[model samples]
Target: MLDFAIFAVTFVIILVGAVLYLYPSSRSASGIPGLNPTEEKDGNLQDIVNRGSLHEFLASLHGQFGPVASFWFGGRPVVSLGSVDQLRQHINPNRTTDSFETMLKSLLGYQSGTGGGATEAVMRKKLYESAVNNTLEKNFPMLLKLVEELVGKWQSFPKDQHTPLCAHLLGLAMKAVTQLALGDRFRNDAEVIGFRKNHEAIWSEIGKGYLDGSMEKSSIRKEHYESALAEMETVLMSVAKDRKGQRSQTAFVDTLLQSNLTERQVMEDSMVFTLAGCVITANLCIWAVHFLSTSEEVQEKLHQELEDVLGSEPVSLDKIPQLRYFQQVLNETVRTAKLTPIAARLQENEGKVDQHIIPKETLVIYALGVVLQDADTWSRPYKFDPDRFTEDSARKSFSLLGFSGNQACPELRFAYTVATVVLSTVVRQLKLHQVKGQVVEARSELVSTPKDDTWITVSRRS
Candidate 1:
């Protein structure tokens, strides 16, 4: 009797599994939407996976499937929306706190039980503003200083030895952002630098582990990540302790410390701020230099713009907006290399785009890289053209892809300020030339960065 009962249970489980496996994912009652029979026949799992790098695979789907396309990413249903009209209709005006908060918790390994309502609200508000205002504003001077340090270092080194543009840019970006987020006291301080280095290594390895599915099974990288986190926390905690009795400064660290929140909240917020700010700016700078070096005409035009506006003076924040063509060059670079190419958000509730229904809990990804390069949207999509972002074009709502509306990166406004300042300063003083036989390929990870070290020779412009 027991053997018969086990056999019946096994049979039911197998039947249920079979049913689930054969179940149609489409919401349509007929288990088939209006997709063309031919197209459906041709669409296969391999084709979906081969669309592009994981970052751009979704946009390729949208390109093939019109404005709305449903696909799977490793068993997870992903919906991609291409049209700005559809995106505006479906994605905007919703609070992203739940998604954003979840990401924060996961990345930093924080428990959800930490903060009260008021504390959480304050932390969120501060984080939002830090993404836009204080972080960027506070970091501008530091960015300038770091650029100067880089220039001095470059000038000191012999031109024959190739300058590792990628590494230097990363270091500079890391320094500037860390200073901005953690305060000047911790920017390059010994303990902070150690923590930053370890954290970067751990996160870099973790990204690899994630792609290879090893993070769960291995403790090596995870251990490093935890160690780095602890060190970072120690640093932040010390800073927070020191600031406990002090008057509030406008720094992000100060803002975080002063908020009526737990110590862990302060540390987690600072860690996110530091990591996010550094990677984006670093990748942007490296790509900007690569593009400027490869295209002499564009570089000349940018240099002329810098000369006309600032005229050999050190580039400053106040002078950034006036550097029109320089700004366009940066915009074009961003378009060419969508730094954060894809953004992922889980649907809070069911949403629809035209005929298709995006069920709740699906991951909705906006593929900025593909959208920015769409042939219909950008003329000569493959060409590097800064003029595409002219004031008129930008004002007319042509999607240039620096930052998306509603889903825009909170830190981009600040990133623009730092990037413009750095680019203008570098171009005004130096002539950048690509190293011989070294072709820079863009690498897409958490951000899009150069695959190999970007080497360039810089000489004082005569």
Candidate 2:
């Protein structure tokens, strides 16, 4: 009778699992009227993967289901918010916190059971900002040297020869960010290469967060992933140990060591900064060069600006703030590229947007895909015009979701300084032109990048 009972229970468990898999609910978890985000075919996650990029997928859903939609990612329900109004409504009005960090935390598996989570988050952000500022200050000389090396390489290339800017830019950014963020952890060229490999292993898997059960599926990938993470922590902990009392303006690890966060916390934060610092910065550099290659008028205007304020002078941080057109170029590039595409938050309590209820713990994603190109916010939404970012126009365009304002990604802000150095150093020396008949296509990875190589021909300016 006991054997029969055990067998019966096992059979029932399997039957329920089958039922749930075969017939997932299309309704809201709370069963509230108007609360349900519009569902695709059978409310399954296959639609997302079918749509190609997360950006493309979100746009398709938003087009069909209005500004807000519901989709499942391997049985997890997520609400996609595509409109600026929806974002304003969902995010705190005062802008105390943001969804970018939430999405990052989700990706990193950050769980702080400590109370005052918001306060802790803010504190950590300040710490990161402080580290970036110090690191940039000390590393500016090194950064310019790297930029010079890139310039020399470009100038060496025969005229009309195509250069793969993405790969070159990634190498440059990898060098700059690692030197700045990791400090003594990567002491030599060989050590940095090893770190870069391990970092890429970890960084690449971050995108796989969207791919369900992928990390566990491959033994080789799993081993590499584990080894990369462990190696990073080991290097970081050693640096942290060495630099406990000593502080260096160039060392992010030193700043982290001085922080109140635990060694593990510091390691995690370093990993986040190291990866985030390099990838998006490389993307920005690639696009900036691409746009300049395509637009001679903008290039000439930027060249003129550089000539006026920065003629043959050492590029410095103070000079960075004075370059208004340069700032506008960056703004336009970020708007057009949508560099960091999506950010999300969790609803702590029940809320409503235009009579539709959002139940507690709902995954609220800010797509930023459609909204950046929204006609109401941007004139000639498809065109790249830096002039549209005048002081009056700038105020209205202030709240770009992924990489702008007080709410912007901190790494983006850090990248901006380094990127400016790159742009200034390069443009001052070289005139960039598009490779004839070369087409650059932007695709979304963890960082949105050129699907094909971004080819540019550089000629030394007379």
Candidate 3:
């Protein structure tokens, strides 16, 4: 009886080992150590859903498997680089084109390519940069006006009233992007409100649907999402038609019209930019203020810097660069919050990271969340210390993470400028205080925001 029991145990062990060895090799195209698909068709998709978000799943995946890892995203094998060295190997400095466009378009279900050839893409890229430059340089007063209005509203609130910080920031961001990118049509309160409603519907779905195919599964939800997208596109199309053939680069749509892109291409680009711009700007401000509210020292330092740079004067574009400490705090907020936690670029040619060979057309994910909080890369990485950004090594790590110098995306560049202006304006006037016993937890979606509506009260500073 003892001999028979031993044989049964040995047989079960052998079977388990065989399945582990054979099954993963079927899905894992490279030698990169990571997860295999639990199911054949869905790949590691359900795993992502179970783990909360793509960012969370990647964090755990990299924790188990070293820096460079692999996982099946649908049928395609995805290679994720989670450390500075791995990211350096994957990013190409010569390639100045946008990397997130393809991934974003895929998630949004926008099928049209950004023109047909490489030349067309390059033309569009130049026009995009021109639009951003023109929007900031030519329309500085409009941005300042918007910030003043927001601050005025905050001041109107009764002293010690707990203001809903996220809602206000989201509204301000919507107004800023729609007015600056689209046109004055969005200046109407009704138009801005309607646009915000649709933006919320689409963005909420895009974040959820990217992880699970649940949005498409329900006919009602699928129709509602498509309807919201169509409505936003219609608004963009009208704006484009109004600006067609006009040489003035006042708004983003006008600048794109100056190029040879088809109206459809122009509309698509505008939608992508508007969607990305609003979410990023809103959450960036939310996290920055929330962090500052928790730390009085950080707030005092920012206030001191504002006094040193511009005493009792509002922030201007020319003066933004001189406020180095303010920029450092913003940079630190981005790192600590993992604001835009993930970004991806498709490898067109076969590439090598360390010893692993990446096949052509493989999707390479930059796991920015894991790298942002890596202990080796940043000391006390989880703590909200802006001083860490003052070091050369810390700056290099952030550069490798793609938030510095020429690597920052246009939307981020826009957000940084807007945030600098907004945060500086508010901190100089009012002191932000967190509501007692209110613990804000991050809900990592396309952008990391507080899981619930975050609230803070303001007291006029003396």
Candidate 4:
């Protein structure tokens, strides 16, 4: 077990180094007090395990080491920046890459030819970016279709009690993102079902540093992962083959089919986008509902805005911009939930943050968990007050990092739209109430989520 554990962490470091394109491979971490440019990293699995949950562990580290601290994760140079100011100085550099992509490089590289060099990966990333930009407007209708389906499902449930939203939201997000990303290639429900099964297996392994083959030690999970991955590739290749020379406006795959990336590369990108889109967007919706349930003042404000902007009407894209309060609700949810608890970058050359020297080749993490709730920056930092974002204070920025100005996370922007729509639709129709005695603590996933995450009750407003 010890031998295998060491091997996994070592492999993960190389894997992260290879696929994380934005990170400078050379040594460069600066601007942190007492950080050694040449400090040796300890490679002990027990050390990592002893630390317990990564999110809680990082929070504890911030308490002990101040906002910025250096530590070793199995020989990997890690620097954690717990404050917003630290982020602005170092990670807020325009070129920072989304840390979510690090997990993608390894997980999506499941069998696709990736992590070799940045060339193909870069090109493929561009193509995927193009697909998203090209297809989001075209796909918004598809998104609404899925949203309506979800609403219908919820509407059918008994009105007296709460529904388990986590599982259902996962399905709703999976189906919507799949249809948009894969186009008609995954039209069959079975195909979507199969993809979801594989996705669950793969997603659960993320953020745990992809712990060796033990994650797939279960034969069933291993089987589903491999089979679904192969199916997705076959689907993308077939679509790319047929549509490369054709013109289609509705599907993301159609946009990709026109790209220079090979079918496998396209498939790899599509898979990542699909899986990530599902998890992040679903949780965003969940957290929004969770927050709303806990804050009746915010809920009333949001519902009033939704009713004022879109009363007795179905939610539409044109009206979304007018749903300002709903947007604040979602933003506040992300901020309070710390949906993305951390983001990181690698220093190619020694860098500095706030006059402190950061050593070279260190993983500089933007500890969003700490800053999003900074008492100095936010009035009542722990509260779920969306009104803090009213126009009088709207100009204030950098506090809500959910999907703010950082375009590093493509899916997050997409999720913002999806979540806004969900809030618009749900708040207008039902009043959310917290589940009595339901435990709703934050558990750090790749995206932060409520622990033992269940659902809130809702009743049709009179």
Candidate 5:
């Protein structure tokens, strides 16, 4: 009996070893002619398991491997590009899908490829129409009202405890975005906040799971995603049902309903629309305020622009375009901080890159954060100089990772408008300052955000 047990144990161990040995590893295909399984970079797997905070690990590899480097994360192959020229190759409009959506589907357990294609198309059309006609024309007044509410709320909070700017910014973004996306039905409602909480919780957890490689195997992530989706569907459907008899407004949900989308598509697409705007806009606001507080020069320049454009009156959408420096500051913020650092895509059919051929259906990631900060493109790449975007030196075809022409996320244009309005309104009224001895750091997820507890002080500018 002992001999038989030993034999079985040895057999299992050998079987596992054989499988690991046969698994294809990631390799640099830059100078090579064809795809071949290459040896894994030492410590690469360990860094991935550490949840993507291993900046030193990735930086070292890129330094050694040149502009294009390949590495493995579990059973997946990741290609990192560190130059604008190479990055542009992957951003060709011919590519139908983006890396962000691919990572999202994988994390959320949705089907990839054509799964979200119809919904994506409808959402894109509605977003374009809304941006061109609805947002600036129809929704600006409501947005201003929402901004006023946020300011009032800030005033209500005790001065000493006013440091929770991150939380307040998130709430403000949610209120404004939801009002525009789903109408005023769920805006500030308890149910809406609850749904946002569930969705955020699941989305955030899945990011952690992906970095740790547990999402692929974790039952907890599966349950969280399922629950969040159900809750989102319920809330959106309820809002839609309530608006059934009413004439459609210019809001996103109204536009979607008027389109040929089915009820499920309406619910899912509406949730994605709202959630995407809230997290990103909120983070941008938080970071902008933090940066302004740290740099008096930037703040002064921005205030000058705002005052010159619309002095002593509330900011409006019509006036946003005239604030050139303010716009430059926002563009620089996105370029320097990299809100959405990584963009990804998958090969539909076999495709060639340089000399090597990528197999059909292989996942490809473009680490936009790395590429955006590439030394070759931007002089003093790590510096936060808004002047880089000024008319004298700004690249005519400047592309940041947030939205590229081919790989652009449709929601980005709206996000830019919302962020511009919110920032302009707040900066015009308040003088923001960072608290002494406090540190603000970025935490990357599906979208990067200031560390959850980031705090700042606000006083009315005299």
Candidate 6:
């Protein structure tokens, strides 16, 4: 769902900057309260940078301006909604269109099938979402096998050995997503390693490029980014070509290919899924473990639930929903971490969010980080209490924030299921512990992650 983080906010500014407009200096056209442009072209760009991240900026912006707020992006009007009421007014939970698909494609520079009619667009969206589910469902055993391989490695580690949580999970996620999306070819360690290198290069470059406008100014950086993108695309294209006219398990590429989507469409979707799926899945696991490591009560509760639900059995797809408290732990972890702190959608037409009048084509930001931790909505908002999600209202609030139910992005849905399996498998057998004297603070960026590489240790449970 938050697949938009790497490029959405910065992409909006760059896209709007190309077609300049002069917004009023004193107040927004929508009559919402916000910062005026610091410069004619920059708008409140410097303000966002000074605040460190768009998520951080929106938190402070809402704190001062209330639920509905506005800001200028390169002289264009941008509105941000920070409360549940404001979010419901702006985004319907049942909306068919997927906002992240648009933003992610724009950032990836993949324009295939973009000009299709609404029917075609909706068809493709359904195909993408279904493909994710199909991949996970059909490849459930492979998912378990891949995760178990990682767990096995950890099992062999010495009791005092501290693991590099982020790095390890990233590798596991890459293996899982690539193998499941692109098919069995990714089972080869060399193939997965090469793809990971290119993926990391492209991902890092894109994040840095959008943040500082480096891609435009530094020819070398641009060249590197393009080279990595080209290499990755080449790999995806090869896989897509091979999948053509071949009968196989309904993996992501196969589903897209079997449909009416063009070859370019298949390749674009494959690359997008691979990139977005791996990062989100990895970070979700990272935070889930990080939180579990610090709280023994939470861990014990989760372990007890796992015991009651599975009782010496490994996690299977059917048994997942039965692990209710485990789900709550993951949900609360997502809330506390504010993973994917912000998401955005463009206003299709003039709309009203509360009393504010949003204009057509306006860039609307969902200040999810602000809403997720709002005290009025969640009791002791900053506290990581999974029990808070036991109520039906918490689930509804979470869905409204686009982190649950049908409203969740395909990436998030995929991550949730994957995390369910991994956590159920690992935590069922090992007791996770936080590294002594180590502090992990979240760095709110494209994906929220620990400010540094987090280290954790695990001991075999008796």
- The C-alpha lDDT values of all candidates are 0.61, 0.69, 0.78, 0.65, 0.60, 0.81
Q: Which stretches of candidate 2 lie over 4 Å from their true place?
A: 1-43, 74-76, 93-102, 112-115, 184-187, 247-249, 391-395, 398-402
For candidate 4, the per-residue lDDT at 80 reads 75
List residue ranges in candidate 4 displaced over 4 A: 1-11, 14-47, 92-99, 110-130, 209-228, 391-402, 406-408
lDDT string for model 3 (1-462, tens) is 000001111112222232212334465668778888777655677798899887899999999998999987556577888988887777753143544554566566564265457676556656776888788887789999999889888888888899898889998899999988987888899999989989989988876653456765688987898899999998889889987866566888888787777888888889888988899889889999899999999999999999899997778889999999988998999999998777776667788888999987666777888888988798998999999988999998787666876656678888888899888989888888989999888877667888999999988888
Q: Estimate each model's TM-score.
A: 0.80, 0.87, 0.90, 0.82, 0.82, 0.94
Clashes of each: 0, 0, 0, 19, 1, 0
The Cα error of candidate 3 at residue 44, in Å, is 1.8
Give the Å shift of residue 291 in candidate 4.
1.4
lDDT of 5: 0.60
TM value for model 2: 0.87
lDDT of 3 at 48: 84
CA shift at 322, candidate 2, in angstroms? 1.1
Clashing pairs in 6: none
Report the poorest 10 consecutive residues by lDDT, candidate 2.
Answer: 1-10
Worst 10 residues of 5 by lDDT: 1-10
Residue-wise C-alpha lDDT for candidate 6, range 1-462, written one tens digit per residue: 442222364454564356445555565646778877677777777888888877889999899989988887776777888988888877763244555666667677776346766677777778888898788889999999988989888888889899999999999999999999999888899999999999888877555466545567678977888899999999999998887888775688888888887778888899888988888899999999888988989889988888898888889988888988988988998999998787777677788877778887777888888899999899999888999988999999898777887767798888988998888888877889889999888877666878789999989988
Q: Is candidate 1 or candidate 2 better by TM-score?
A: 2
Q: Assess candidate 6 and give its lDDT.
A: 0.81
Q: Using lDDT as the measure, name the better of candidate 4 and candidate 6.
A: 6
Off by over 4 Å in 6: 2-17, 20-27, 93-96, 112-114
- State which candidate, 2 or 6, has the greater lDDT: 6
Candidate 4 per-residue C-alpha lDDT over 173-208 given as tens digits, one digit per residue, 9 for 90 to 100: 888788887677666899788777777766766645
The C-alpha RMSD in Å for every predicted model, in order, reads 8.7, 7.8, 9.2, 6.0, 8.5, 2.3
Candidate maximizing TM-score? 6
| Pairs in clash, predicted candidate 1 | none
Residues 182-300 of candidate 1: C-alpha lDDT, one tens digit per residue? 66576556855675686686557434444333454568866876777677678778877776657646467776665566787777766665676676677778888887878778878
Better by lDDT, candidate 5 or 3? 3
